[model samples]
Target: MTGSASRPRAVLIAGPTASGKSALALSLAERAGGVVINADSMQVYADLRVLTARPTVEEEARAPHRLYGHVDGAADYSVAHWLEDARRVLAEAGGEGRLPILIGGTGLYFKALTQGLSPMPAIPPEVRERVRALDLDAPALHARLASVDPETAARLRPSDTQRLMRALEVFEATGRPLARWQAERTEPPVLPAEEAVRIFLATDRTALRTRIATRFHVMMEEGAMEEARALLARNLPADRTVLKAHGMPWFARHLAGGITLDEAIEGAILDTRHYAKRQDTWFRHQLKGWSAMTVEEAAGLLATMA
Candidate 1:
């Protein structure tokens, strides 16, 4: 989190989808002579750029943007990979005498950058496949995890398959609990939170829901389905994160003739709303000491920082 005696190193803009985060990031970058580095997991994939609502060509032309749409759809991109990319971008921005404006809806990226991520060993491919193939219900798997890694199991809810499976996979691969690896992290924080302007956009819940639905419909109209069609043609692994991007699976179903377009739209809208809610909840609890404000308020605050 070190910065020059004169100025902070970066500005972090975090919020739920459709919360105007991209606009704010662009505004801040324009003002602060910064480069916009992506923090969103979905935006990293090249295949679902429109579906992920990445910045448009015009918006990007206005400023230097890095790490967006740089990943292939079939690659198993992870948070660790993003962290490494972000570190390099931050260095590049610094060397260019520009601030690094990290923006996205993903809280984990912010957490990893600020708090430092555990250099946990990778799970073997077979271990990943074995865990993904298990059809056990959440509670059953939680019970199994409880036996091998009771500490992590107790911390996570029974319904949280993502974390539970990750913990199980880590233990199965390395014969050590995920918690143990996390506790042994030796890396320093990537970006010190104390030296950054951290802004979280908290919009009106009903208005956000409206924006999510409206923007999703816009994506459908603006070639999101075509993006999905191309991605489907690739036949990427189902377990890949790109396949689970908000509304992606529903759009895929629609393209496959398994569902009506209207139904697909409704399902995508519902899933996005759920995801946004989770993002809001996670930021509320996980991100501490960040100033939560509306888009306009954030812009005004960034002016002071500039």
Candidate 2:
């Protein structure tokens, strides 16, 4: 009774893609009076709804969902922005006395909730312009980043252009590498991990791979090709963030007669499965403190805690 006297009954349902997290969140919401909170990065973009797998029409109707696909596709949203939004939702839910179930596959968002996010400054335009001048070749950018932020560079795969650009931009803006800033900060989180029941609903890799493949096929059958083609005809920049949605370019090309539909489907499935693998590795290594449990187990734990 002493420990249960004051607990903010919140639930976090997170895992890799195709991990049945949405279903779990729905179930938890029904039983616990919780509203689902968006945690997926791609799902935050309004334009990539189908490609990003934002929850379906049925799912949204099942429970209240906050902050899904609410951002401009062109807008740059960081983990910090998401954390602020999450705090607002948490506050609202707490006031309403509704259970708050944060759900998605984004490990970084969960990390930000448990461990304080670093207060990194915005990159100055001059720094952005400088990095923009460098060729986009993977190795060249990787080398450039290595010269500035060796710690981040050492971990980045050569092909990680997004991260390489970010690392270099941070170094140029601050006149110091990102690694230095990260090493210096030691602030506690706004929410202690113990305050909420945390769960990472990892699925079996093989089963997840099959689910990814089947889902991609379903997507195509459900008009994904048309979706890509429509976006392409908008004449958005190939480098535009929306144009680069997962598997979008390939489907756009395939629809344009540059490749067979069969090849596009295969490529899309492969890319998603690979992404799932990376998510698995990240949650396993980086989230060492959060206790790992299946979705049901996590719900059970939360129930007993209350």
Highest lDDT scorer? 1
In terms of TM-score, which candidate is strongest? 1
State each model's CA lDDT, in order: 0.83, 0.74
Could you estimate the TM-score for every candidate? 0.82, 0.77
Clashes per candidate, residues 3 or more apart or on different chains: 1, 0
- Give RMSD to native, each candidate: 5.9, 6.6
Residue clash pairs of candidate 1 = 1-192
By summed lDDT, which 10 consecutive residues of candidate 2 come out lowest? Answer: 1-10
Candidate 2, residues 182-291, lDDT tens digits: the string is 77874576566777767787677888899898888777777777777777777765445556556886788787789998888888788778778877777887666666
User: Model 2, 266: alpha-carbon shift in Å?
Assistant: 0.4
Tell how far residue 132 is off in model 1, in angstroms.
9.9
lDDT of 1: 0.83
Candidate 1 lDDT over 160-276, as tens digits, reads: 999899998876544567787778854688887897878899989999999999999899889988888888888877766688777887888898889998999899999889778
